[model samples]
Target: MQIPVNQKFRLLSMLGEHISMCIIGVPLMGLSLLTHGNWGFYFVLVLYLNKDFLNGRSPLKRLLNTQVQQTTDVPANEWQCFLRNTTLIIWPLEVLVVAINGRRRLGDYLANTHVANVSEDIGSWKKELAAYRVTSYTFYTLLATGLYLLLVHTLFDWLGF
Candidate 1:
C-alpha cells in the first residue's frame, strides 16, 4: 500500500526525533564512558526511553511540533507510551523488516498505527529547515565535539602516546 503524505510526514518527524536523540545521546554516552565506563550504555538507554515516555515526542519532534499517538485511541496513555518506547529495543530489526517488506514494519502492523501530520501546516520546508538548523547547531555540534574528544583520547591511550 502506498503511504500517505501525512504518514510520510510522520516518518520524517520520527527520523528527526531519532537524529535528535543521537545528537544528545552520543555526548552523554561519551561523558558517561569517560566517567563510569560501561555504564554509559545503560545511561543512554534510560535517558532515551525516559525522554520518549515522558512526552509523546522528543526534543526534535517537539521542535517540529509533531507527536506520536496511538491509532486506536485519541490520546495514548502510559501503557501505550511504554509499549511504544519499548519497541525501540528492537527498532533496528524493525527497520530492516520494514525495508525488506517495503513499508510494513512491526510498529505499523502491530499497533495499527499511522503517523499523522499534527503540525498546523504540512509541507513547510522553511519550518523544517529552521528546525534542522537549530537542532544541528545546538545538539549535533556538542555530539560531534564530544565524539572527537573521545576518539582522540581513546587513540592516544591505545597508542600509549
Candidate 2:
C-alpha cells in the first residue's frame, strides 16, 4: 500500500524512536552482562513500555513535534500510551501491519491512539532541526555504543574469554 508523504515521514521518525532506544539499550545490555544481572534488560523493557511516558510522545516524536492522541483528538493519557506500545512487543507483526496500513499500527488501534503532527509549519521543523540536544544525544550515544562494543570485543578476544 502507498502511504502518503507525511505518513512516510512520520514512519521514519518513529523508526528513529527505535534506533534512539537501541542507542542506550545496547550499552545497558553490555552493562547487564558485565554485572551479571538483568537490570539493564529490564530497564530497556521499561523504556520501551514507557517510551511515551511523560508527554505522550517518545523522544524522537518529541523532537519531531508529533504526539499520540486519542482517536477523539485529545492527547492520549499515560495508560493509552503504554497500551499502544504493548503490541510492539510483537514487532514483526506490528511492523508488517504498519507497512501495509500506514502509521497507525495494531497497538494504536487497541489503545485508541493516533499519531498527530503537532505542526506542519516548515519553520517549526527547522526550529526542531536546529535543536541539537535530542539529535546530538542520539547520534553520540550510537557512536559511543559502536566504540564500546568494539572495545569490549577486543578485550574479550585478547583475554581469550
Q: What is the lDDT of residue 28 in candidate 1?
A: 78
Least lDDT summed over 10 consecutive residues: which range in candidate 1? 73-82
lDDT of 2 at 131: 49
20-48 in candidate 1: lDDT tens per residue?
Answer: 77887788779877896755555565555
- TM-score for candidate 1, please give it: 0.55
Tens-digit lDDT track of model 2 for 11-112: 686678778988989999899999997568657866786687544667677677777787776656666777787665577787677788777888888988
Off by over 4 Å in 1: 1-7, 96-105, 108-113, 119-161
Angstrom error of the Cα, residue 57, model 2: value is 1.4
Clash pairs (backbone) in predicted model 2: none
Identify the leading candidate in terms of lDDT.
2
Which lDDT value does model 1 have at 86?
Answer: 48
Best by TM-score: 2
RMSD of each: 11.6, 11.3
**Structural similarity to truth (TM-score) of each candidate:** 0.55, 0.69
lDDT of each: 0.52, 0.68
